[model samples]
Target: MSDFLQQVVIGVQLGSIYALIALGYTMVYGVLRLINFAHGDVFMVGAFVGFYAARALKLEEQPTLAGALITLLPVLLLAMVACAVLGLVIERLAYRPLRRAPRLTALITAIGVSLFLENAGQLLFGADPKFFPSVTPQGAGATLNLGGATISKDQLVLVVAAALLMAVLWYIVQRTRIGRAMRAVSHDADAAALMGINTDTVIAFTFGLGAALAGAGGMLFAALTYAKILPLMGIAIGLKAFVAAVVGGIGSIPGAMLGGLLMGLSESFVRGSGFSRWTEAVAFVLLIGVLLLRPAGLLGRFAPEKV
Candidate 1:
């Protein structure tokens, strides 16, 4: 039981990161009905942003709780903002002109953009993996015991931060005017435009918002789970998160969260059982199983065309 609990704890921690990234995927899919396959590259950019931000602030030198907070908050915000702009640029330059083109054209463009970002990252940051600087305070990373499970400080912080971000996102979607506009546009872009909502602006905002979340996820993943950052690292993680979004039902907010948690738990359990090599394979298997059982996804409902 204790062993199982430990895996659960680890699963939840991993799930938080996956959930954060998956939200971006579902949101973009909801608004645009297009998968921003380049999103993973945006996440990679966020990690780099966080890396430089932390280094510039000298967080590595001033390792204290207060200092860590000072460094962490600013780094996170900057990374989000940077990625948000990148998202806008991607939409405007790579995707906008092609909106009227064939769906295959846009999909190809997305792949092109993704490749550009990855190659650019490699050119700028090099192909060698870089070690992320530690922001933890002096002797601060101890594990805490909870219900017969050990929770690391990193895991606890990541989980809490993810929860907070998700809460803020929920509020935005549920209560804000822009949120309503987003929903309206997602439902029917032409109708939303007729209703005086700027579909373009709403779509752009959705991209920015999703990108920001992905940025934060990138930073968290680097700081907590994986410190090694390479230009292509996002590929694997992004694929998994994409699978999570699909599993939860693409375009369904709650489904994305549920799918992320399930994916993480299954992977963690598999790893715990010493099947670490098959970890990546599990996501695809689950996706196939879900598709066979419920083609729409675990939470997705099929909507017939009104035409």
Candidate 2:
């Protein structure tokens, strides 16, 4: 029972990470119906940005609580801003011209962008993995007991942060003018444009907003146990997040979050069962199962077009 509880806690932590990235995937797809495969690369860039931000701020390798927090907030904001710019650039140069082109063309361009970012990242950041700076102060290995289970301070912080970010995103989508514009564009781009909403600008903003979230995900992911950050780190993580979005219903924000948590639980359960080798494959298997059971995902609703 204790083991089960522990796994559940870990699952939530992983879910938080996946949910953050999946939100980006769902947002971009909702607006453009484009996968933006390069999104994962933007996440990689975010991690790198966080690293440089830390170094630039001269953060100590081992920091006090106050110092760690002072460094954390600025680095996170910096990473988000950097990735937002990168996202805008990708939209303007690579995707904007092809917006009216065939979906196939746009799809291929997205893949091309993904490849370019990966290779370019390797060239710019080098191929070797770098240790992410710890955001927790030294001697901060605190744990909280839940039933018979223990949850680390890091896990608690991540879960809270993810929840806060998700809440803010929800508010933006539900209450803000830009979010209303986004929805209007998503429902009918032509109609929205005719109604005087700047469809093009909205689409670009959607991309930037999603990319910024992905950046936050990158920073949090790296901070987890001080994970290694590599140029290709986003590939697997991005894939999982994509799966989460699909499982939750690609265009539904809430669906993306639910799907992430579900996948995280599944992976954790599989790992606990001693089939750790199947951890990665388990997510895809769950995706296949979900598709077979509900093509539209858990919360997804779809109506077939009349022929």
Candidate 3:
């Protein structure tokens, strides 16, 4: 029972990471109907940016909490900004031209962008993984006992931070004027433009928003795992986040979050059952299962075509 509880805690923490990444996927898809496969790489880039900034600033060597935090905030902000710019560039350079092209063409372009980013990261950051500076101070570990289960401070922090980010995204998407414009464009781009909305700006805003979320997720992931940044790190996580978006209901904001959390927990449960080897195949299996069960996903609603 204790083991089960511990796994659940871990699952929620990991799921938060997935939720963050999946939000980016779902947001881009909702607006453009494009997968934005390069999004995973955006997360990768964020990790690298944070990693390098910390290394350059010697964040790990900071002698005081205030010093470390002073450096961490700026680095995180810079990483997020860089990722947003990268997202905009990709949209303009690779996807914008293919907007009127066939879906297959756009997909091919996305794959190309993904490949380009991976190789480019390797060239720039090198093939070796580089560690990120610890944002959580040393010896900061705390635990809460829950029915014989222990939840660590790190897990708690991760879960809360992710929830806050998701809340902010939800507010922006559901409450803001720009969000309304986004929805208008999503529903009918031409109609939205006819109403005097700048569709290009809306599209760019969507990409920037998604990129920012991915950047935050990348930072969270690195902090939780204490893992170094790597070029190919985005592929697997990206695939999983994509699966989460599909499972919860693609294009639905709440659905994406739910899908991500559920997928993470499901993976944990599956691994706990002694099927650890099946972890890699879980996303594909879930995707196939969900498609078979509900083609539109759990919350996805199809729009009626105009005759």
Candidate models: Cα lDDT each: 0.87, 0.87, 0.83
lDDT of 2 at 92: 98
Error of 1 at 87 (Å): 0.4
Per-residue error (Å), model 2, residue 102: 0.7
Model 2 C-alpha lDDT per residue in residues 32-149, reported as the tens digit of each score: 8889899888889999998877877766644454456566888888899999999999999999999889888998999999999999999999999987766675454556789989
Q: What ranges in model 3 sit over 4 Å off?
A: 61-71, 139-141, 304-307
lDDT of 3 by residue, 172-219 (tens): 878999999988888888899999999889999999989988987887
User: Rank order by TM-score, top first?
Assistant: 1, 2, 3
TM-score of each: 0.96, 0.95, 0.93
- Candidate 3's displacement at residue 301, Å, is 0.8
Candidate 2 lDDT for residue 184:
89
Candidate rank order under lDDT: 2, 1, 3
lDDT of 1: 0.87
**Model 2 lDDT-worst window of ten:** 61-70
- RMSD to the true structure for each prediction, in A, is 1.5, 1.7, 2.1
Weakest lDDT window of 10 consecutive positions for candidate 3: 61-70
